[model samples]
Target: MVRGEDRHPSLSLHLRARQTAEYRASTAEAERQLRDNDPDARPHRLQHCRGLRESGCNRVLGIINLENFERENAYGESELRLLTTIAASLGTALENARLFDETQHLLKETEQRNAELAIINSVQAALAAELNIQGIYDAVGDKIREIFKNRDMGIRVYDPKTDLIHYAYTYENGKRLSLESEPLGNAGFAAHVLRTRETLVINENMTQAMTKYGSYALPGTQVEKSSVLVPMVAGEQARGIISLSDMEREHAFGDSDVRLLQTLANSMSVALENARLFDETQRLLKETEQRNAELAIINSVQAALAAELNIQGIYDAVGDKIREIFKNRDIGIRVCDPKTGLIHYPYTYENGKRLSLESQPLGQTGFTAHVLRTREALVINENMEQEVAKLGATLVPGSQMERSLIYVPLVAGDQARGLIGLMDMEREHAFSDSDVRLLQTLANSMSVAL
Candidate 1:
């Protein structure tokens, strides 16, 4: 221990004997207490020794027992730097082992989460690419199955017009299929979400609940236990539900599952909207193509017919075209001799170019005169009461028809030439904006052809 002594003087036989004795004593005491199940959480304490020496003929370091478990051990002024260095190395190694174990667990958890998120992203991508509404539903169902690694899944859609939630899709036994729409009430889970715009979950005995929304009470399936019902809310509207069910697992639907489902549901809302818009665009495109084909035919017919043709022939050709365009059950065209003040001609058809009733006189009626004066299309929607007031009966003199009428006057440069008319004989279907625009398209083109 003197200054300038050999750095690691070899331990003599006598010094080795003393150091070995101390090590055995500490080791025996530590083992005895641990065997007795002693809760001695403290680290082992080493005893101090003197008269120590390095073993001979060996590259060995000095061994000295220091006092004080903490205060004297830390390297500072008046410190044995080598002993302090040894303690520091051993302390760091132990801490490093604990830190490494902790990091391993964290990495494992993160990897699992990443894998699940990857599955979710793939599902969202598939849903977004769907151009048909049904396709999106199917993709969502399949994604749910894949994420649960081919487990079961289901979905519901809420329709505001019908005020009902309908089962739209389900995944069972690793396969997904469209769930035929089954009406569900506006109360319970549906109402809770609708009122609060919040999510709904029922994680109890799903099979025991005897309702349409209940799990596996599906009229075709056996009882299933725990289930989760998630609301697919979008655009201030409750679009659908994603219900999960299993025959086992009481803790299947927990807060964690609900939160994950919510995040997925938000993505689902976006996917649903994208799919709906893509579908609508495709439908509009197809209709546009059809309209263009019809216009091609009309242009050909227009070129063949002349400007000097009598009003009656123009009425016949235009009526035919209007029937093609509107596809109404009944359509009529009438011409009035303005100078003669008498009925000139009338042409009518019922459904797809069928030879309707015989040609009738315009009868110089005031209804014709009124429309001729206005030169504006008048549409009356389901006017049985109005007809009773005008025609003095529950119906008109027509063969057999109900519903409504659209009266349009042919006005070319302030000259009221004639009129084109229609009556949806049976279907009480209200006309939409597109329907009105289509009718106007036919009316405008008919005026030019006439």
Candidate 2:
């Protein structure tokens, strides 16, 4: 019961310690006096003339001295009885105080745990924004480590072809594995669990008589004492297996532990599947965007081949094409006429970040002009040295950040309309292939706008 005696915060213990110290000192003084001339009534020698006073206060505990303790000048029966009564009354109060302390401690622990869980939830949500395979795996495994107190956990991605299990990521050894082989192969409990796609529990005694899973487990990877293994399944397909190794405790895991692992695995499975699909979607979107961008460039070139009937028409036609394909609003057609080296023909600005006809020029002044001269499309960081300041021409006072931008040039035989620029406002998010193709095609269309 005194497992945490050193940590006890009882006011009673302090009082008792103080009282015992005082009593020991007094007894020593009494014994020293007894050694002197008066041994029989030594107590009388020291206290014969002392005045005693009693204070009015609610008493709790009572202490009883033995009958023969008078040799030590101890209390009489009445006083002993009173001490007993005090102790009796204080018993219930002490018990209640202990209970209240325990409850308060438990409540504090629960609140701290709740705060930790909230942080984990936020991390998981942030992970959700990522749609990459490795990113998803890292996120899931990281989350598993965190939920399980960031201690011991293992993962083996399913190999449908080889039909074997191997470690995907292990929160073990800081890369200094206790088990052999960096990636655990088909052998011990891991293989057994993964091969069967079944749940395994090694509550206590990790690497023991695991006969049934002998063929399934990692060689010598034994359960040791306590561990839990669960198969990670996604879309009815086994994607991987999660293994948790227990550290120093009886009944290392319980039903709640099992349920929690299963729940996290399920979420991880779904998240992995979603990430893969999103990656594929991104690929598809890229291809489509590339094709559209090419067609737009072609259209711009062809339009330039014709006379500039209505520069606004060319600008609108191409700009609308870009908005439809790339989902961008900052689009404009710039022309390079031997008559006028630079000209900006516009349709409409969007996303509330418009292009200033006065300051921010379209062609080479932006990415489009550079592309026109080199006949190469240009993509640049939206927050470069010069652009950082020029951005103010379009953005609000303290907000100058966009994702990325691209520019394509229109060439008509020997002549070319300066260039066309398109932009979006989510950095590190590059323009899609379809967007490039569409812009190129629109560049082809800008000659007439010139």
Candidate 3:
């Protein structure tokens, strides 16, 4: 009501009562709706009506209800001035409270931010202390778990040569876990990450997440509620992936969590790259050493072959060097007589002992005969027992028979000259491709010497 109005005091009181009833009804309905929508919603705070204004300003901070002041008559000047003063005092207090609450919130936020910054710095420091992939992975897992309280994480290192994803490191339930490598085509979470080279954030059902990734969740004892898969990329190449998972909390990861993990992944990528380079360098060094050793063996064999020695002397010299080079003691050099059509074992060294096998017909009964007939190198292991039996071949005639054998045809001219056989009765697949090649080279040199 306007001041100094020619209106009845009864009318003014009736109008105020009606307005209060409407406000109560509206407030009750709003609270009911809110409670229905959210079971855990808080009760609505009481709000006062806006009535006071100074200097044409209408910014309402808060209000104080005066409904209990049951005045039947129109308010006089003294009561009006008192109500205005109360309104101004209430507005000032409300403004101060709002400012205080904001300041407290900002302080708490600053503390949280500082704590996160400290964690990042600590992780960076830990990462810096490591120069290898495994060490970096361990540092990341420990630091992240210490700060974020997560215990499940996995690091996969990609080997391009083998095209395999190797689980380099893993932590689960506060314990370090070791894992085996699998082919990249395996249908699992890590495999999918490696194939796609994309970061996957899963906060919902794991089955659905796996389906989205076009695979099933890798078999594990622990169930995961939320997870993140970040691909570790160095330059244009993807080195591996870091999988962060939570077994307990759904929606455990946030935008900030993803960013932190990505940062860790980037740092780990560089470290893995460094480790790969180091490994490659070591491998090259080893290859060079092996090459030098083989070259020296070849030179020694040539020098011995060129000496003015008899057939027995040549066989002894070659047998000694072959044993030294191959590090195998079971060796036999059989020379074939083109006229007699039989193989003659002039040199038979078995575990540093000389055995006498004067001569035998070149029939389909042994590996030497098979090589003499076919003129092809044959490398046989335990798996090739059926093939060896079909060939009806037995070179060494004892308990230490055909565990593994390599028979190379020695050819000097247009026809097969003889056969050189090496056997390993202790191990299967002990000889690699290089071993076969080097032995063939020795067989050729021996053929020429004969």
Candidate 4:
């Protein structure tokens, strides 16, 4: 029975033994073929495999292993052909997958770039719509916070005239903070940016970065972990700086953040400059209007004085025109009688009511005598009572006390004919140099008329 079993080995056991023998023979033959072609063939580790190559290029993508054959001639042309087909299919599939992944990555990057551009366009539109500097600052601040997801930011305007950096806008942790203007010395991050006219991105160790740039933390400010500062450059000069900071996280800002903030700073610089030009234009326009108005008043005064035939009529006309020009009703005209040596009040109005005064000796001491003596215009904007007292003068009886005064000597061809005085009881320094010039022009016409 044992001999019979050895010869036909229980069918399953015989089949396994025969399969092992065939596999060994097939592996040996394959290894021998490889060795015959190449001396470096490691026959012990040989396996049935195929190269997964890319189409056309014939680039080997990878290797694919098939199950070892269990019989001689089992891995023949048909099996080799099948393995090659599988390898080709797998190579194409892997290439398609890689291409699809690359496409997806590129799509995501494009979408991110588009989003950033949209935000920048929105910010530009917001800034363009504003003509006020404060409005521009608010829009910029709000947009920066929205994009960065942080609330700490500031905009500083550099004033070349004063050599100072003014904090136009500042917010920290969602709270608005007021900061005073400081000298633009060489010791701050803003100063560094202004000096270099470049952007700065510090993602960690802000203090160390500042130190590297020869800068220091401002006395009342908290140091942040990360910061991006951009110069608001216009033409060749840096107009200001825009700074954004993160308090909790290092590396909060990156290259993209720096680029975006720099773009924003450029837009802000243009908007601010436009606002300034608009303000300057409006101011000049207002001054022109005021000058035109004053010229009109002076022409009317000249016409009125030219028609007056007598000295008193000229005085009355002068008083009326002075009231119209100054909007103040308290006015007086003191005429020096050259032959009589007396100063006479030809026309005087107090609080819009006419007043009569007796003639007095033209002494060397009072304000009236001083005007006639010096033949020059005098302005007293404060301490009128003390000033007049210093000039050896006293207020007329029943006269309202005045706080502001302008006295112009009426000179006719180098001779002081008289004086015209305008007073404002309510305010000191209420008159401008333009006012004095206008009054002097009127006095010249009065002197000619007299």
Candidate 5:
């Protein structure tokens, strides 16, 4: 017999029996006829069948066939009932197995989702405590190490000011190294990831990877096996990149692992942005405080400069005002005579004592002399000896003279009249730009007072 366009022997008999929902008890004569119809096919002398229908849908699953069953005597009614019962039991067993497999698959998927959620929650908690980008990187790196058990990790940040991406953190073999690199001109995998904003996972021998994609190997590190690169993207901008490598070639960073890391990467981008915003807020607050302090000092000095006119009163008021602002005891003001090219230290205050006033030739030599000549402010924190040697000017070494010094030229009506000299005997970088500018303004006010 034939089913559709294909010829079959006993198989067609079995199928037809199932389609009609009837039992087929074929004999030798039927088998002979089937063989004659399809000589190439195998013919069963006895083909006994019963339809096995699913209980849920009442749809026939297939036939439970007894091929080549020898029945010497006539079949009994009890035997046909046994065959029908066996077919029904087989159908139920098949359905149960299908349901069991489906249940197992669903359970595995649920567990996987749960694990991913747990990782995200843990990372988010860690991120909440970070106020800076480095802290965020550290927290994320720690979590990555915990979950992946691989210390070969790196996080980079894109610096728009420099137009370069720099490595913020890199961990390998229990050591944290300070490393910086640029993401320019297809430098390496990190650069590629940043530019493309794509996640790349390669679980292969490092040598092979390098051979295949030589342009992707990072510059500094010697690779042994595998790597995963995930871009930290916030909205449409690619902010940075994270790279994790494994020494073992056959690493377990499968499809699911890549997905989990991508999710974490997204979270990291948001966390980094938040940290940056927080840092910017703190910086703005600090700037506001500094500006307020500067304004207050300027106001006090303006009042003092306005109230006092005599040289002695002006000197005393200027000394008090500078002391109040700089909080430094070693402060002095000199008046420059353009006629004689001389700088006269008319007022010098140090440690609550007044130094005997002295005068020296302003021969375009010392730091103060240079300020007088150029009419510019100078801040020096190192190489004091070089300035001293270059200028060939005489200076009284005070009790609190230090490496760092500031010289602000006092000018009035476009003529350099005098300058103020201050020394930081305690620390370097102590005199900030704001301090210098404030003192310069005060010196100009003093010049007018003079």
Candidate 6:
């Protein structure tokens, strides 16, 4: 029996007569000529060339050929009827075998498909549980390796703002590989997938695929014989690529393999987007809390200073609030008397100890006079010694050298009436921009209270 255009005989049964050797040789020659499609080959002599068609169908299941009969009309009508009966039975049996084989094939494919679906479900579950990008990479990478049974797999993240591709996760021969970011120019399979937002499967001739796509490979990876690249797309935008490769086998992946990975890649893209949203929400929540806390601090300080009626009482209230706001105990308030060219420090604390000093003349030099004259705030977190010297400011006789400080002027209408200064002696860069803004707000309230 032979099937289709490539007529290679699949089954043969022999029934030998007296001229068996001659008969077999002739049958072999006929089969070869037919297979080769030789136009000049003659039809068999005394052979029943009628095709054995399946019942009620024109489809030829097999052929019954009888060559080199011992005599002309060796057997009569009875013999022909017997041969026809035999051919009918043979055709029926052949058709049954073919159907059985097809049924088995379909069953196997269904089972394989069910297994792949289960694996995809498991991967989706794992990805959904992860709240960070790195966790999503791990889940997708592991599932890709398991499905393809390939040790080399990678998940690349593309940053459109930078036009760079970063290998967030990679494995080579079941071992982890660390990689750096590269420009996502018109090169490499990963870049191609990201640019087009399409899936690529290279089952053979990887060099051809590379040439057709772009002839570039990652710096730290080995050349692969077969590979598949699927873009991780969410909505209309592609975020990255998921890639799997085999170093030793050609045709290692097929259409089904590409489909499975593409499904998994889609799930990964959703998970990554969710993780980004989660992180952004967390950051915004924290900023709101910080702002609320700063407002509360300002309100509390204003209430405390408002309750004091005298300048001395206000200075004491500010000192108490400053201590609560800052870790350092070095703080002071200087009130300027414009008519007398004098500045008085009614409140000064250094290392938790209060100091009493006489009022000094507001001279042409020193940071105190500069702030009073200009009504501008100053912040010094680095090169404190040089900054103080540049401003012609002198340190108190028994105080520690200040490393970080903020000085804000207290202004009323067009004139700055006083100054509030805080210093940290132990650390540089101890104040942030937010801290400066907070102090300026407090200074405004303090100016009103005065």
lDDT of 2 by residue, 1-450 (tens): 011233222111211212233333333353353347344531221211111111233322222222231234444567546644554455445546766999997885675455446434643564567535555556666766766787678766766666655565665533324334334356666566656778888786444546644533445443345678888777667777877775556577888677667666665666555665676797788767666665665566457447564755555655666666555556655555555554544544545454445323333444444465677776665454466445332432233445676767767776555667676665554666656765666565445434
Can you tell me which runs of candidate 6 are displaced by over 4 Å? 1-63, 67-116, 127-130, 203-219, 249-251, 254-256, 266-450
Model 4 stretches with alpha carbons more than 4 Å out: 1-130, 267-276, 290-450
Each prediction's TM-score versus the true structure: 0.42, 0.37, 0.46, 0.49, 0.53, 0.50
Highest lDDT, which number? 6
User: Clashing residue pairs in candidate 5, if any?
Assistant: 365-391
Across residues 1-450, which tens digit of lDDT does each residue of candidate 3 receive?
112132222111111212233333332453344347555533332122233222234544433332212333334567656766876765565556667999997885675565456545644565466434455556655665665666577777888789888777777676677767767776667666666778888898887876765665444547688989899888887778877888888998898778767766776566557666775685677567566655655566567657766667767777777777777568878888889977778777766677786576777577777787778898886665677678886644443465687889989777898887887767788677766877777677666655
lDDT of 1 by residue, 283-334 (tens): 7985795577458446744754755556555566666656666655477776
Model 4, CA-based lDDT: 0.70
Arranged by lDDT with the best first, the candidates are 6, 4, 5, 3, 1, 2
What does the lDDT read for residue 425 in candidate 6? 73
In the order shown, the candidates' Cα RMSDs to the true structure are 16.9, 16.3, 13.5, 15.0, 10.3, 12.8
Better of 3 and 5 by TM-score: 5
TM-score of 3: 0.46
Question: Candidate 1 regions off by >4 Å?
Answer: 1-130, 164-166, 173-178, 188-197, 207-216, 253-256, 285-450
Q: Rate the local accuracy (lDDT) of all candidates.
A: 0.57, 0.55, 0.66, 0.70, 0.67, 0.72
Ranking by TM-score: 5, 6, 4, 3, 1, 2
The lDDT, on a scale of 0 to 1, for candidate 5 is 0.67
Tens digits of per-residue lDDT, candidate 5, 1-450, equal: 432323232233233324343233334434454458676754334345566656666656656444432333334578569878887887787777778999998886785565556546655665566435566567667776666665577778887667777777787656777765664555556556777899978786656656555454346655647778899898787888777766655674677667767776776677667666776786688667656555665566566667765666656666766776677557788888788877777677665567766577777566677787789998877776676677674556544455677888888888888888787666666677666766776676566655
Question: In candidate 2, where is summed lDDT lowest over 10 consecutive residues?
Answer: 45-54
Q: What is the Å distance of residue 199 in model 5 from its true position?
A: 1.5
CA lDDT for candidate 2: 0.55
lDDT of 1 at 23: 37
